[model samples]
Target: MSLLHAELRLILRSRLAAASLALLMALSALSVVSGLSAVSRQEATIARATAEQARDLAAVAKAYGKPDGEAGYAAYYSFLLTHDRPSPLAFLALGQRDVQPTVLRVRALSLQQQLYESETLNAEQALPGVFDFAFVAIYLAPLVVIALTHDLVTSEREAGRLRLLLSMPGTGLWRRRIGLRYLLVALSLLIPAGVALVATSAPAHLGLGILTVPAVYLAFWFGLSLLVASRVRASATAAAASVGYWIALTLLIPTLANAAITRAVPVSKGIDLTLAQREIVHHGWDIPKAATFDRFLATHPEWRGHETFEGRFHWKWLFAMHQVGDEAVAPQVAAYRASLLSRERWTARLGWLLPNVAAQGILHRLADTNLVAQLDYQDSIGAFHKELRAFFYPYLFFDRPFTRADFDWLPSYSARTGTASWPAIPMLMLLVVTGLILAAGAAQMRRTGRDASR
Candidate 1:
C-alpha cells in the first residue's frame, strides 16, 4: 500500500504524467462544451422553424380558408413542418444527427419524394466528424491511457527494481499496482466527463452508455497496456506499439469498415422509391380516374362505396389517387428501410471486437443519437405523415369546406420520446470483454510477481 502510494506520488510529480492528465481533462471538457453548444444551436433552429411554420400556416389559412375553398388546395399548398428535437443526452454523442436531417417540411406532395432530402450541411465539417464526448472517449482517451500505462512493467524493470521487488515476499503487490494505475487513469478520464456532464446536466441514460463506452473502453486500453507491457523488454517499445495500435484500432479500422458497409449497401434505393412514388401520383392526372380509384379501393375496400363520382371532378377521386401513389412505393420503402437497418445490424456485430466501435454504439444508443434512433425517427415521421394524409383524406374526398376551423384539424408533428432504453446485449458484451481482460491481466500479474521482485 505504501509502495502504491509512493508510485502515485511519483506519477503526480512527473511532468509528463501531470501534463497528460491535465490535457485529457481539458480536452474532455472542451468537447462537452462544444457538443452542448452545437445541440443548443440545433434546438434554437427548431424553435425558429416552428415559429416560421406557424406563420406559414396562418398565411395558408388566409389564402385557402373559405366555405367554398376545397381541402385539396389547402393540403397541397400548406406544408406541415415536422422536426425531431435532440434527446437530452445528445450533447454526449452527436451521432447520426450530423448526417440526418432533424427538421423537415412536408406537404400533401408524394411523401416518398420529400422524405429523403438531407438538410444543407458543410460536408467538410461532417467528414472530419464531431468533436463531441464520443470522439474524446472512443479516440482520444485511449491515447491518454496508452501514455499513462504503457510503461507499467518496463519502467519498474528499467529502474533496477525487477529482481528486488519480485523477491520481496508479497501476495497483493501486483494486483495493487495494476489496480492503482487503472484507478488513476480512470479518474483522469472520468473527472472531466463528470464535470462536463454536471455542467451540461446531461441526462442519466439507460445504463448502456455508462457500461459500454466509458468503462469498457477503459478496460480495453488497460488490457492492451498489460498485454504490451507484459512481454516488452523496453518501455519505449511498449509505448510505441501501444500508441500505434490505438491509432489503428480507433481511427483506421472503424472508418474503413464504415466506408465498406456504405459502398456495399448503396441505399440509393431511397431515391428510386422517391421517384417511383412521384410518378404514380402525378400520372394520376393523365391516367383514367377510375383506374386510380380502383387502385385505392383495392387497399381500402371500406371506402369502395364512395368511389362512384357524379361529376367531371370529384374530390374523392383526387384524394384516392394520392393514396394509391403512396401505396405504389410501399415495397420500395420497405426495401430501402431494410438496407439501412442491415448496416446498423452489421455495425453492432463489428462492435463486439472493436472497443472504439463498441463505445460509439453504446454512447449513441444512450443519447438516442444512434443510426437506429435516426431510423426510428424516420419511421415515426412516416407514420405521422400517414396520419396527415388520413386526416385530410376524409375532408378532401367529402368535398368538405377547409375553413380556418379545418386548418386546426390538421395533425401536428409528433416527436419521438423515450428512445433511450438500455441496450442490454451490447452492454453484456462489453462486460464480458472487461471481465475477461481484467481476469487475464490478473493471472499474468501473478506469474510476473516474482519476476518483478527479481
Candidate 2:
C-alpha cells in the first residue's frame, strides 16, 4: 500500500503526467456538457415542432371538415407528423441522428417517397461528427494512457532506479504500481461521465456502456504500455510506437471498414422504393374505378357491401388507389431494410478487432440512436400509418360522414423503444485482445526483472 501510494505521489508530482491527466479529465467533462446541450436543443426543437404540427393539423381539420367530408380527400390533403424523440442517453452516443431525419411529415401520400427525404442539415456541422463522450473515451482515452505509462520503465532505468527497485525481495511492487496508475486513469475518464450522466437522467444501461468502453480500451493501452516500456531502451521509441498503435487501431481500421461496408451493401433501394411508389400513385389516374375498388375489397372484404353509386370523385375509390400504391412497393422497402441491416452487421463484426468501434456499437445500441433503432422506429411509423389507413377506410367505403368526433379517433404517433443489449461476443473479443497485449507486455517485463538486479 505504501509503495503504491509513494509511486502515485511521485507520478502526480511530475508536471507532465499531472498535466496530461488534467487535460483528459477536462476534455471528458466538456464533452459530456456539449453532448447534453445538443440533446436539449434537439428536444426543444421537437417540442416546438409538435406545437406547429398541432396547429397545422387544426388548420387541416378546419379546411377539410364538412357535413360529409370525403375520406379520400382527408387522407390526400392532410399531413401527419411523425417524430422520433431522442432518448435521455442520446447525449452520450450522438450517433446517426444528425445525418438521419428524426422529424418527418408523412401524409397519406406514398410513404416510400416521404421516408427517404433527409432533413436539411448542415453537412459541414456533421462532417466531423459530434465530439461527445463516446469520441473522448474511444479515441482520446488511449492516447492519455499512452502518455502516462509509455515511459514508465524506460524513465526508471534512465534515472537508475530500476536496479534498486527490483532488488528488493518478496515484493510485487511492479504490479502495485501498474494497478494504482490504472485506477487513477480510469477515475479520470469515468468520474465526469458518471456525474453528467446522472444529472442528465440517462438510463442505467447506457451508463453501463459508457463505463465499459473505458475499461476495455484502458486495459489494452496498459498492456501495450507495459510491454513497450520494458522492451524499448529509451522513452521516445515507446511513445512513438504506442501512438502509432493507437492511431492504427482507433482511426484507420474503422474508417476502412465503413467504406468497405457501404460499397458492399449498396442501399439504393431506398430511392427505388420512392420512385416505384410514385409510379403506383400516378397509375391510379388511369385505372378504372371499379377495378381499384375490387382490389381494395380483396384486402378489405368488410367494405364490399357498401353503397357504390358511381361518381367522378368518390372518396372510397381515391383512398383505394393510394393504399395500392403503398402495397406496390413493399418488395423494394424490404430490400432497403436488408441493405441497412447488412451494414449494421458488418459494423458489429468489425468491433471484434477494433476497440473503438466496439465501444461505438455498444453506446449506440444502449442509447437507441443506432441504425437498428432508426429502422425499428420506421417500423413503428409504418404500423401507425396502417392504423390511419384503417380508421379512414370504413368512412370512405361506406359513404359515412367523417365528423370532428372522428378526428379524435385518429391514430397518434408514438416513438419506438428497443431493448438495450450489449454485444457479448464482440465485447469478449476486445477483452481477449486486451489481455493478450498486456500479458505479452508483462512477460517482457518479467524477463528483464532479474537483469536489473544489481
Candidate 3:
C-alpha cells in the first residue's frame, strides 16, 4: 500500500501526467453528458410522434367511424406508427442510430417503398462519427495513456535517479509505477461511465460488460506503452513510437479495411431492389385487375372468393396490386439483406486483428445500436406490416363495415424485445489479445530491471 501510495504521489507530481489524466476525465464526462442529452432528445421526439399519431388516428376515426365506414378507405388513409426505442446502454455507443430512422409511419400499402425512404440528415455532423463514450475510449483514451507512461523510465534516468533507485528498491519498482498509472487511467475513463450506468438504470449484467470493455481496452494500450518505454532509451522516441502504433491501429488500418470490405462486398442491390419494386408497382396500373388478383391470390388463397368487385377501382384490387409489387421484388430484397450481413460479418472478423474495432464493436453490440439492431428493427416493422394486412383482410373480404368500434380493434405494434445479444467471440478475442500484450510487457520490464542492476 505504501509503495503504491508513493508511486501515486510521484505520478501526480508530474505536470504532464496530472494534466493528461484531468483532460481524459473531462472528455469522458463531457461525452457521457452529450450521449445522455442525445438520448433524451430521441425520447422526446418519440413521445411527440406518439402524441401526434394519436391525434391523427382520432381524426381518422372521426371522419370514417360511421356504422357503414369503408374498410378500404380506413386502411388507405390511416397510417400506423412504429418506433425503435433506444436501448438502456445506447448512450454509451449510439452506433447506427444516428443514420437510421428511429420512428416511421406505415400504411397498408407497398411496404418496400415505405421502408427505404431516406430522411434528411446533416452529413457534416455524422461524417466524423458521434462523440460518445465509445469514441472517447477507443480513439482518445490511448493517447492519454501514451502521454502518462511513455517516459516512465527515461524521465527517471534523466533526473539522475535510475542507478540509485535500482539499487535501493525491491524488484517491484516497475510494477508499482506501471500498475499505478494503469489504475489511474482506468478510473479516469470509467468513473464517469459508471455514474452514467447508474443514472440510466442499465441492466446489471450489461453494465458489468460495458465497464469491463474499457478496462480491457486500456490494458492493451498501457501494456504497449510499457513495452515501448522499456525498449526505447529516449522519452521522445518512445512517445513517437507509441503514437505511431496508435495511428496505425485506430485510423489507418480501419480506413483501409473499410475500403477493402466495401469493394469486396457490394451492397448496390439495395437500390436495385427499390427501383425494381417501384417499377413493378408502376406497371401494375397498366395491367388487368384480374392478373393482379391472380398473383396476389397465389400466396393469399384465403381471399379467393372476395376478389370480385363491381367497379374498376376496388380497394382490394389496389392493395393486391401493391402486395404483388412487393412480392415481385422478394428475391432482390433477400439478396440485398444477405449482402449487408456479409459486410457485417467481415467487419467482425477484422476486429480480431484490431483492438480499436473490437472494443467499438463490443460497445455498440452491448448498447443494441449496431447494424444487427437496425436490421432487427426493420424485421419488426415487416412483421407489423403483415399483421396490419391480416387485421384488415377480414373486413375487406367479407364486405364488413369498419365501424368506430372496429377502430379499437386495430392491431398495435410492439417493438422488438430481447434483441440485444452478447458479443462473446469478440470479447473473448479482446481479452486474449490484452493478456498476451500484458505478458510481453511484464517480461520486457523484468529484462529492463535485470539490465539496470548489472
Query: What is candidate 3's lDDT per residue for 1-454, written digit by digit as tens?
Result: 6877877888898999999999999999999999999888898989999999999999999999899999998999889999999999999899998878889999898888888775334557768778999999999999999999999888877787777677775658877777888899999999999999998789999998988999999999998888889898889999999999999999999999999999999886344666788899889899988898999999999888889989768888888888999999898788888999999999999998888899999999999999899889999999999999999888887889999998898989899984676798999999988999999998997788788788
How high is the CA lDDT of each candidate model?
0.78, 0.79, 0.89
Candidate 3 overall lDDT versus native: 0.89
| Better model by lDDT: candidate 2 vs candidate 3 | 3
- TM-score versus the correct structure, for each prediction: 0.91, 0.92, 0.96
Q: Give one clash count per candidate, in the order shown.
A: 7, 1, 0
lDDT of 2 by residue, 1-454 (tens): 5877788898899888899889989998999888888888888888888899889878767877777776666777677878888887788778877677777777755566787766334558777788888888888888888888888888888898888877777788888878888888888888998998787677787677768767777888899888878888789998998888887888787778899999988887466677788888788889877777777678778877782767687766666777777777787788878888888888888887776787778878777788888887788878778877777777776777766656667778777766466768877877888889888988988888867763
Best by lDDT: 3
Instruction: Identify the superior model by lDDT, candidate 1 or candidate 2.
Output: 2
Backbone clash tally (model 3):
0
Clashing residue pairs found in predicted model 2 = 227-441
lDDT comparing candidate 1 with the true structure: 0.78
